[model samples]
Target: MNKYFLKTTLALTIGFSSLGMLPGTSQPIEVEAATTNTQNNNQAVAAKADQLIQTGKSLIGKSTYSNTVYKPTAPYKFSCATFLMYIFEKNGVDLATYNENYMIQQGTYVTRNQLQKGDLLFFKSKKTGTDPDHVGMYIGNNKMIHMADSKQNIVISDLNSKPYYTENYVSARRVLPTLMSANPATKGDKIVQNAYDLKNKVKISTTNNEKYLRFTAPGFVEYVYQKSGVNLGTTNLKAQMNLGKTVSRANLKKGDLVFFNSVKGSKTPSLVAIYAGNHRLIIPNSDGVITRVLLVDYYNEHYITAKRVF
Candidate 1:
């Protein structure tokens, strides 16, 4: 028999044995014996139930990424929100089309105490209010798989850590079908891989009349122009600049923010952007537009460390 079936059968058998009272038995000795057997069986069933629970947990933990590239059964590549959508899809749950707006609209929007494994965590940098700036897959124990700014890349993080996220904790959304599934591997692995790829491909540029400062490097420039509603490119550059300060490049990640020194000892770094893993930065240099550039070129003399903003 399959492991699941075998375990179920064993548990039932133990439960039945514990209730040792047999039909058509009026004798005191037989009744006493049945009661004793029933107690023993009950203990055995409890032990078996605990073991099965632990085994299931272990299997869930093992369902993680290998080096292989994931090709979703669906057309689009996986993302933070898309990953959850896929899990629900695989489990036979039909959701609205996979989009950021759709997910946000469908999400339950609960507090941290309501969070469980396989929930979605949202964050923002604004202090007074909770504006959704970033999204991540919550994997339990206060850890999540956020795009993690432009420098940190797609990695796990603690929700209660640092300045911005800790204070700006928005809300957690639990995708139900995932909890009902037998396997969570495909969804989990795809989410992590997609987050990593997103980090690599993030490009920062200029928009909304923002000035694009041409750095000395070929095809590279600092996106000095800032405008509303523009997507910052990489994570590294974002981490450095999120705090409006300079940080060491060595400590940067794919989704981190970056900053450059235009003026000495100034709180605001002259140029700010996101770190796109592989030594690239994305910034909004043009008016209301974001662009991407090489890190070495952008920070040749003005290289600075990064800080976590999400």
Candidate 2:
């Protein structure tokens, strides 16, 4: 709903030129690396596009459009930008803001000929003039799904079928390549998935006598891992240190047990959390709510070690 004018030129160039294989070897070292990265990116983008499209489609007729405010919860109500934000976050990609002008500057720019599924298309209408005031997702086949207006709510429209869309087309941004931090395999990670499901739903309080509130920091870690078919046998903090092979901080993977020393003089770990990839940790906050926090500063200074059980 925040309004502003487009600050940059919309004309963009594509940068993904393929490289030929090297001599002697079927593929050069650099070619192999580039190919691998491209393949991984393609897989990630495809999965994210499917997820975003399906989620948006599911909300059609059930959701309403609003350009004045943003509704973060269910019984969906959204603006053009906020709608994209909601669907992207639901699929583990965060667009970070709901302002169309600011969002117009995110990620890489894609030419019309290179348009792919999941690319965000920005447009300007008569009311907005040349400023980027509207946004939607390119759902392939030269079509886009957007929160058109209050009357239409959420609907799919053809880009070429409408003269208004073609005349007002401003630019497009490909965010899936950069926003989708995890590959397709990470979506299939049972440990990570289980941890995500338990976020904000479980408690970390050790002293609460409630039947459903018996989880400590270690207990929470143990429960999530156990739910994923990996049994650490005990919730004891020290016992967990020897449960799995040690993993270096640089080599840490998602779902690894990241231990930290909470007490000043304690040599062993007093707290444990799951590494949720992208420098994020899933740990219980002081209020006993399971949440995610960046693993920096305080976490960096109190770093102990990590273990990969799965």
Candidate 3:
């Protein structure tokens, strides 16, 4: 049991106001539309949001809620905040902690009338007093899905269906933008997308072929760049590291080549990976499978330098 989960309660019903198009907005004007690449990126992010909602829906009957305890693994057991932590982490957006007060402090505040799907909803109930004690994901149509209290497992409820939600609603925070903004439709996004597309589809080998290989971390980065029309020209990690404009770790954009010292305490670069934005890296494992992983702990500690080649 944790202090954060104490005094939690569930409100059975709720509802939200609908937002419709403005009354006089019925004509197309001569204006440029969002770039095709950006549109695609937005679509991809939106798809991820939909997937987040579906993931929460899938846990409905299988998850058990408890205000007194939190079990981080499945078969699942959760508190309201931990439930958000689980679903968001499953979709690659780490909420980081299972504390509602801390979570409410994250992302950016959003007005209740402007709530969008995937926004985190925080509320204060009679038991929780002035502090926000409950959290849930806004799942469009003025509805939200949450691990409602010890009585209700994971379930959905209309926001306006009960006065408890409307009257006590504390606030909402928009975290989807954190994921979406990192993937704006730039050439780098295309390169990162190519890397993702090639994950398990390519063969890693020392022999070079027309279809692509010279298999090594450098080769994988080269292949992904070539597919997206940028040629790095060398298979040597150190040589590749020297080919592009030098970039600091903090300014790295998607598709930037992040070089690292493979040997502990060595300054020379022995490995390279693609920066996939939002602090994620696209690199291959020993078994030759490419994967996206968080850039924390191990990778952060082995940091050498980065370069923007694309």
Error of 3 at 175 (Å): 4.5
Which pairs of residues have clashing backbones in candidate 3? 13-162, 14-158, 14-159, 14-160, 14-161, 14-162, 15-158, 15-159, 15-160, 15-161
Off by over 4 Å in 3: 1-51, 62-114, 120-136, 141-143, 146-154, 157-184, 203-214, 263-265, 287-295
Name the regions of candidate 1 deviating beyond 4 angstroms: 1-79, 87-95, 126-131, 177-310
* Alpha-carbon TM-score of each model against the true structure: 0.30, 0.50, 0.57
* Predicted candidate 3 versus true structure: per-residue lDDT over 110-149, tens digit per residue: 9999988889998887564565878899999999998887
Model 1: how far residue 149 lies from native, Å: 4.4
Of 1 and 3, which scores higher on TM-score?
Answer: 3
Candidate with best TM-score? 3
User: Candidate 2 at residue 299, lDDT?
Assistant: 74
Residues 1-310, candidate 1, lDDT per residue (tens digit)?
0001112111111110111112354211111111111232435333332332222222222123221222232122233443333333332222323333334444356678767554666665545433464566666677765434324434567777777668766677654432221233233223222322222222334222223322311112222111111233433433335444444666655445556666555554566555544343444332222223342333656655575433
| TM-score of model 1 vs. true structure | 0.30
TM-score winner, 2 or 3: 3
Write down the lDDT of every candidate, Cα atoms only.
0.38, 0.66, 0.67
lDDT, model 1:
0.38
